[model samples]
Target: MKNLILTTAALALGAGMAMADTVRMGTEGAYPPYNFINDAGEIDGFEREVGDELCKRAQLECEWVKNDWDSIIPNLVSGNYDTIIAGMSITAERDEVIDFTQDYYPPTASAYVATSADADVTGGVVAAQTATIQAGHVAESGATLVEFATPEETIAAVRNGEADAVLADRDYLVPLVEESNGELVFVGDPVPLGGGVGMGLRESDAELRGKFDAAITSMKEDGTLNEMLKKWFGEDTATYAPDGSVVTN
Candidate 1:
């Protein structure tokens, strides 16, 4: 009986260790209300929230790492981290590089921006993620837009008037300007670019992609996802918030 008991304990320990699923994620700790570094030196924001949720749903452990925007894709491809969930959008160009899980949130659904001038550089190169909707807008426009290493850089450019305007997910910037002293305003409605944040998995690790997508879909089904959204964007802040819509307390 003693030998049998020892074997059972060993097996249990092994199973426990095996079941301890861990996923490493990367994000830019700059985009406030999304993902940013706090005074406590801890990472927090909307994107982080989504990452946490997916981990819980998938019953996996999650470890977050601070990453520079310019190097995020390269690092993910290099296997530095298990995945990236830093408000990363789904794009054709990126799709060519890596596999992705189903979207956890709408891409530009709640993301919009404003500037000193309503010049409408929606298709111009002003301010946007390199391969995101904002960049697409800049590309469509004839203006020269700038790409920065992170969202904080873009927001700073807008705040200082160094750039014409900063374009990102509207939900992110709306709260920013409202919290600011008074130097920013919306240019138009929330531009629907038809995308959202998703986990970027390695092209070879298709198995993990299925795991993440299943987790994301489960969150969508349960009310946990909705509750999380409300906590971030208020009861009505995130849902149905169109472009140019004023969302302030």
Candidate 2:
């Protein structure tokens, strides 16, 4: 439960003033394909590309800020950043705390990876990133849920025999499973949850949210969002239509 530590000057200036007119985009720079730190130590991934385009369409000055996944929401609310463009799914619980733009990415699948194809994913110790839908599902699914601060740690738990399986976004796990050769394999049907992935904003920032919402709408209508999805998540990934319908190609 590590928290964001800000300087006295930073806190005194107020979180909103940290960027003045520029919108600070907050993300967990650990989730690959969605977001991760590149070799040059800069944020890189699907969210980075999408966030840049959204800012371009909204005509807003924007910059990226890396934050830990465990504190991402709290940091956004505290004004460490103006918006969250992380791979965060829209959920009712989160919606009550922070408003979200129209979904940029449709609700996708969650899958479990275990050492053996026949592993009892539904009943064994399951590792999942803290504060995620997959973790919540595991907590309520009669399995022992072991929470980790980062996505990589969740997978590591499975690999090190600390957990029987790891549940995470299918798109995130696909590459790992494939690269693991026979060490890891899918064990159960994909579990779908949340509404979709959207930018998180404070309730008071309706104007900012509206701008991103419109940008997302435009991307879906023109298929740029879909193209980016395929480029990062693969051509077979499910995408969102202009009206938010799930369109698999």
Candidate 3:
């Protein structure tokens, strides 16, 4: 595993070398737009919607499972889930452990700050999950590290100053910061990271890879995917894709 990732932003998930059709997808539904737990207690979000579309296009039964971000990849590797749909960056390092699909959504990396005040938090030591590319970025920043299993816990780490900041995704922090974590903020223009979320299958399921990829491409052509992006990130949706077709909100 080097550092293979989907670059752009607004995505979740690393792929497995193999693929599967009846996918038991994993996500941190707490991260909105990309993946979230709805009021009905059902897993829902951009990636969830995307998964549903893939199931329809590929004619497979798909189930979504919510897991802590820290455990997503491990859980997938353990066979707890079939593929990951959460906004996971497909980095080269991760590619050693898992393979990827053609990027449907891109990857985003950003800094977390206090909502009450603006501070230049970039280029410093920050807190993040272990093994994630964000952790690598934080390591490179030359700041202290506070590793946690969930982004929520990492936010708490910032509030307590255990960490100077949190290096996370832009989409993951918006609703989190807006809902009252007044001392927390998201800083910096998003630093684009690696690959987008894809269907991760056991190394034995290559057949399903073709099906999942086709589903993703079909969603892009039909506009449902972009519409979901707009609903979540608005004009900033441009960061979600490498192509330049986003209609500014």
Candidate 4:
């Protein structure tokens, strides 16, 4: 759901890479609750906890690598990192270039936030993080779409009146709206987007992908994944059912 379109050459390069012993987990360390830098400046968030646990369950030695959101996929394909555990949604457009494990997080909605509850989200300017599904949706929704390099910048655009509203993942925006003290309010209905978030791997890394997929399955079956989802995204967050199926509103 985020990052640039991959080039054919990049995809070919990714397909030719050899497997390594240590799985380098790549992420954009800026999106809070999903992935972010904590106060002590180390990468810490829902993804870090989940990635660590997945690596443990898979019996793999993993290390974290922080990258800018815009270049995350390109860097992964170029061998800068082994897998992308960023808050990246699984979409057909993205799956064309890289392989994805079974979704670790359930499908969630994209929502709009503005200073006013009745903001003109449909026809007015809407800001979204660059190369995201929300940005693509805004572009095709008869609205003025403004793209930013980062999620924080999209919210800033709404606050500064550069855009009428900012559309982003509901999980990411919920805490901001609550902490805004009436400065920021939700406008318009939440739009369901993407399949779900998954770990991205090179197309040639089928064995690696299978390891992560199995680990994710175990987490879902045992309810650990649901517990992590609630811990980071609030108790009302969507989760896996008893049968290991995603249960979303």
Best prediction by lDDT: 4
Model 2 pairs in collision = none
Q: What is the lDDT of residue 212 in candidate 1?
A: 80
lDDT of 1 by residue, 202-242 (tens): 67777678778887667666555666767876676433232
lDDT of 1: 0.63
TM-score of each candidate?
0.77, 0.90, 0.78, 0.94
All models: lDDT? Answer: 0.63, 0.82, 0.64, 0.86
Model 2 collision count: 0
Per-residue lDDT of model 3, residues 1-249, tens digit only: 112132332224444434444577777786666777789999987788778888889888877788776556667666777777776665555666665676666544464565334553554447776556776766666666667766677788777767777777766777777876465666656666555555555444457667787877777777767776677666565533324233333
Ranking the candidates on TM-score from highest down gives 4, 2, 3, 1
Global fold similarity of model 1 (TM-score): 0.77
* Residue-level lDDT tens digits of model 2 in 15-128: 343325899999999998899999999999999999999999999999999998767777877788889888888776677677789887777788899998877787889999
- Runs in model 3 lying further than 4 Å from the true structure: 1-21, 115-125, 179-182, 239-249
Root-mean-square deviation per candidate: 12.3, 4.7, 5.7, 1.8
